[model samples]
Target: MGGGRSRAALVAKARESIAEGSKSFTVASWLFDKSTRERAHLLYAWCRRCDDIADGQEYGFRDGARDLKLDQASAKDRVEAIRILTHRALDGQPTADLAFDALGLVAAECGITREMCDDVIDGFALDADGWRPRSEGDLMRYCYHVAGAVGVMMAKVMGVPSDATETLDRACDLGLAFQLNNIARDIWDDDAAGRCYIPEEWLVEMDIPPGQLMKPAYREQLVQLAGRLVSIAQVHDMRARVGAGRLKFRQRWAVLSAANIYGAIGKKVHARGEAAWDHRVRIGFLAKMGHIASALKETMRGSYPPQLEPKWTRGQLMAAARMAGPVAGVPNTPLRDEGVRRKED
Candidate 1:
C-alpha cells in the first residue's frame, strides 16, 4: 500500500492473509468500520508473516504449518530476516515483502512506533533462542512481547492516540489475556514442538520433572497449573472489558466480542479439568456468533469495578524488557531473495 503496489492490491493480499491465518480475529474484525478494519488487517498481515517465517509455516495454520519444522540455526536466521525487513519498512526503505510494506503504510498513518515493532519482534527472538520461562513473571514478559505489544498497536489502529497510556495498558491487557488463553490451549502442541512456557518454578513446585508434563502421573499437576493460568487470564480479561467500554460503540463491540470469545476458551479449559487436552480448545462458528451477541449486550452494561488489580502493568513490563536489552546483536544485511531491492520505492 505504501510502497510500489496499488493500495487495492495490497489490501486484498493483507485481507487474504488474515482470512487464512485466524478465523476468530477475522470474524471479530468485521465489527469495526471499514478504515479501522483494513488497518487492523494490514497490521495482522505483518505479524502473521513474521510468525510464519520464524516457524517455517505459511500464514499460520495452512500449508502444513504444524508439520513444518525449524531447527535452531534456521530459526535464528529467520528471526533476523524478519527484524531486517521490519526495520526497512519502518524507515520507509523498500522491504520487498508485501506484509512489511503493509506495516509501513499503517504505521505511517497511525503513528505506530519503532519500540512497538521491536517489542513484537523480541517474542520471535525469544522463540528462536529456545528460551523458556523460569518464573511466572518471565512467562508474562514473553506474553507482553508476543501479544500485548500487538494489542497496543491494535489500539492505535482503532484511533487511540499514541499518548493514551491508560487505554494502551488495557489494550496490552487484552493481548496478555489472549496469550494466556493460548498457553492454556496449546500446551500439548507446544510440548510436541519442544517448547514449553510453563515456568520452571511451577514445574518444580508440582514435582513434575522437566519434559514429563504430559505423563499420565503428572496430568493432575498440569491441570492445576493450567487452572492457575486461566485464573490470571480472567483478571486481564476483566480489565480489557473495562477499557473497551471507553471506545466508540462499534470498536467496543468488536473488542468485547473478541474478549468474550477468547475468555470462553480459557474458561472451557478450566472447566474441562482432566479432559482439557483431549482435543484442541476452540469455539464453533455458532458459539462465536453467540459471543458476538453477548458482547453487544455487555456494551450496554454500565460501570466497571472500581479496581482491576493486574499483577503486571505495561509500564512495568516495558521497563523489564528494557533491562533485558536488545533482541539482536548483529546489523541486518540485505536479503538474498531476488525480490529484495536495493533502492527505496
Candidate 2:
C-alpha cells in the first residue's frame, strides 16, 4: 500500500509473507486491478502482523514461541504492552514495536469490527495458557473466537452486503473448516509443544490414549477421524459455495478455489496418514494451476459444485447448536487451521 514503489511488487511480497500466495482472495483480487491490489496488500500486511503476534511469532524472526510466552507476564503488563504498541503503530511513531499499533489503524480504517480483533487476542490467550478443551463445544468456541473472527473481518473488507449476513456466515464456516483440518493434521506436532486441541472427551470415548495415538497403532482410527473431519469440511464448502453463488462472479470463484485447495488436503491426509508428518499435505503444483484455470472457467460460467452434507456426532450437533442457534445451520467454525498455516507457511 506504500505508494511511489511498484504496487504489484508490494502485493506480491505481501502475499508471500501473509497468506502464502495470496490465499483464497487471490482469484477474486486479480479481478480488482491495481488500486484494489495495493489496498489489499496493506490490508493483508495488517492482518499478517496481528496474526503473527497472536500466534506469538517474533518480528522478522521465523522460529520462536517468544511472543506467546509473554502471556506469562502479568495481565496488566500484557494489556499495557498491547495498548501502547498498538497506539505507536497507528501513529506511525518509530519504535521497536509495531504489531498492535499498525493493526489498530488498519481496523479503524477498514471497518474491521473491534470485537473480531478482540476475539483473536482472546484465542491467543487461550493458546498461551496451554489450554485444551474438555469437550467439543469448548473447541468450537475457541475456533469461532480465533478463525471465525477472520471471516468477519474479511467480509468487512470485501464490501459484502449488509443484508447478506449468510455470506459472512458461510465465510465463518469456511474458516471453521480450515481450522478443523489444522487440528486433525497437527496431532503429533502439538504434542511435542506440550499442547493438544483435540477434546479430551473424544479420546476418552474412543478409549485411545493420547500418547499412544501419537504412535503408529492408531493410524486407522486417525484416518477415520480424518475422514470424518473431511466430511464436515465438505459441508462447510457447500455452505460457502451456496453463499458465494450470491456474490459477484469473481468473488464467488475466489471463495470456491480457496475451499477446493484447502479441502483437498484432507485427501492427502487420508492417503498418507503419518507420512503427512514428513511434509504438510499440499495440493500439487499442477493441481494448483488446474484449480486456477478451473476457477476462471467456473467463474465465467457461474458454475459451482453442490456441497456434501456432513453427518455430525450428537455432541458436535449439540455444541454447534449452542453457539450458532441450531445444528440445523452449519456447525461452529473449526479451530484447527491455525496449526496448519503455522507449519505450511
RMSD of each: 9.3, 8.1
Model 1, span 303-344: residue lDDT tens: 365244667778877877777755533322211222212222
Candidate 2 Cα errors over 4 Å, as ranges: 1-16, 19-36, 58-102, 303-345
Which structure among the candidates has the greatest lDDT? Answer: 1
Instruction: Give all TM-scores, in the order shown.
Output: 0.92, 0.72
**Against the unseen true structure, what C-alpha lDDT does each candidate score?**
0.86, 0.56
Q: Report the Cα lDDT for candidate 2.
A: 0.56
Highest TM-score among the candidates is held by which one?
A: 1
